[model samples]
Every structure is written in structure tokens, then in C-alpha cells.
Target: MLFAHDTEVSLRAAVALVNSASEPETMRTTADLDAFFAEHGYTGRHTGGADELAEVRRLRPRLRTLLTSDRDTAAELVNDLLRDAGALPRLVRHGDVDWHVHAVDDDAPLAERIAVETAMAMIDVIRSDEMSRLDVCSDETCDGVVLDLSRNRSKRFCSPACGNRNAVAAYRARRR
Candidate 1:
């Protein structure tokens, strides 16, 4: 694995959150936020409502910058995030997951928890010199983040849909 299982999960969640803000936004309602939280297996105080949803949505741009920045800049951004959140890392295991780090209290606001977790995971990526694993989507029409976790580091699109679209376009061009 490129990183610990929990670290990879956190990074994937962060990428999904960032991509949700792209054109044709997928997270436009409280229900969307709830689904996101559930899908990511987030265990914490989740006050479901428009205000909470807005707070989470506001994190996208900052996370995108962190994910796409150079290694040094990404480290600086992660440091800033951890400092701003007053993060204190500790090991915690809940549900089916094994022991892993949780850097914020369970009662912390969902946005803060999400941010701090993403920042903490980035710590591993930065330290391991795996910043190349995080990248902007290759689809020129989409401004989404792509996490290349494949063994060969061959992932180049944010989603299968984008990859298929580009492939179809290439095939058509070849036929012409």
C-alpha cells in the first residue's frame, strides 16, 4: 500500500470533497453532506443541517490547494491546518477499523474534523515523498483532484467517467 489504510481512506475522502466543488457540483444539499459523511465512515458528532453543510463545502478550495501544491507548500499548508485546528493526534479504533490516528476530538465540528484528518494524512504523504500520488484531474474540462493509488501509478483521471470520455474522444479522432 502507498500509505496506511486509514491514511489512504482520509486522502480519498479529501479528494472526493474537493471534487464535489467542481462544475456540476454533487454536494448541494444537507442530504448530500450526510451521504458523504456516511460514505467516508466518519465517526463523530455530525450536526446535520445547512450551516454544517456550508461549513464543509467551504473547505474544498483550501484542500484543493493543498492537494495540488508542491511538496514544501503542501507541508506548509498541512502545518497551518493542524496548527489552526489545534490538532492533537492520538490513536483510536472504532467500528471495524483497527488502531489509527484521530487528531481531533469526536465532538469537534465536522468541518474541523475533516480538515484535520486530511491534514494529518497529508503528513504521511509529505514525509514519504509521495506528493506525486496527488494530482489534478487530467480531464481538461474538469477541475478535480485525482489520487493515484494504483500500483503502477497509472491513474490519470479523477473518475472512470472522465477516463472513458477521453478514451472515446481519442478513438473518434483516430477514426477520422
Candidate 2:
């Protein structure tokens, strides 16, 4: 794999969280946030309140910026996030997950944990010189973050929807 299992998972989670805000905002309610956290296997304290939701929403743009930034800028952002969160890396095993790094307490604010975890994962991306794996969706109309985890680094679209859309358009163009 290009990165550690936990790192890849965290990176994908970060991308999904960022992409959920690609349009007007898919995560508009607590229910939406809950669903997202459930899907991402986020295990921690969640306020299930407006403030928590708002903080998560605020973090989306920052994560997006990191994905689209140059290596130096992304590195700086990651370091800042880690520093800001006062992350203290600790290896922990929970639920069905194996031992992985948890840089903050489980009871920490959900947004802070998310930021710290994402930043820790980003360190692997930067140190491995694999920042190119983070990209904007190739679809012109979609502003989603694409995490290219393929062995050949060939993934260009953020989701199957965009990949299929582009494929269909290409086929039609060739037939013309």
C-alpha cells in the first residue's frame, strides 16, 4: 500500500468529509453529520449539537485547502493543525480496528480529533512524497477532492459517479 492502513483510511475519510461540502452543503443537519460519522467509523465523543456540526463544517474547507495545496504549504498546514490541537500520538486498538495512532483523547472535541487525525495522516503523505495522490476531481463541474489510492495512481475522479460521467461523455465523443 502507498501508506499505512490507518493513514489511508484517514485520508479517505478526510476526502469524503471535504467532498460532502462540495455543493451547497450535504451535511446540513445533525442527522447528516451522524450518518457521516457512522459511515466513517468515527468512534469518539460527539455532542450531537449544532456547535459540533458547525465546527465540523468549518474544518471541511481547511482540509480541502490542504489537499489542493503545494507540498510546502500542505506541510505547514498539517504542522499547524497538529500544533493547534496539541496532538499527542498514542497507539490504540478499538472496536474492529487494529492498533493505530490516535493523537488525541477519545473524549476530545470531535472536530479537534478529526483535525489531529487528519494531520497525522497527512504527515505520512508528505513524508512519503505522495502528495500527488491528493487531487481535485477531473470532472470539470465537480469540485470534489480525489484521493488516488490505486497502485498506478490512475484515479482521477472523486467518485464512481464522476468517473462514469466522464467515461460516457468520452464514448459519445468518440462515436461522433
Lowest summed lDDT window (length 10), candidate 1: 135-144
Over 14-94, each residue of candidate 1 has an lDDT whose tens digit, in order, gives: 999999998789889999999999999999899999999999999989999999999999989999999999999999998
Q: What is the TM-score of candidate 1? A: 0.98
State the displacement of the C-alpha of residue 10, model 1, in Å, after optimal TM-score superposition.
0.3
lDDT score of model 1? 0.94
Q: Candidate 1 — which residues are off by over 4 angstroms?
A: none
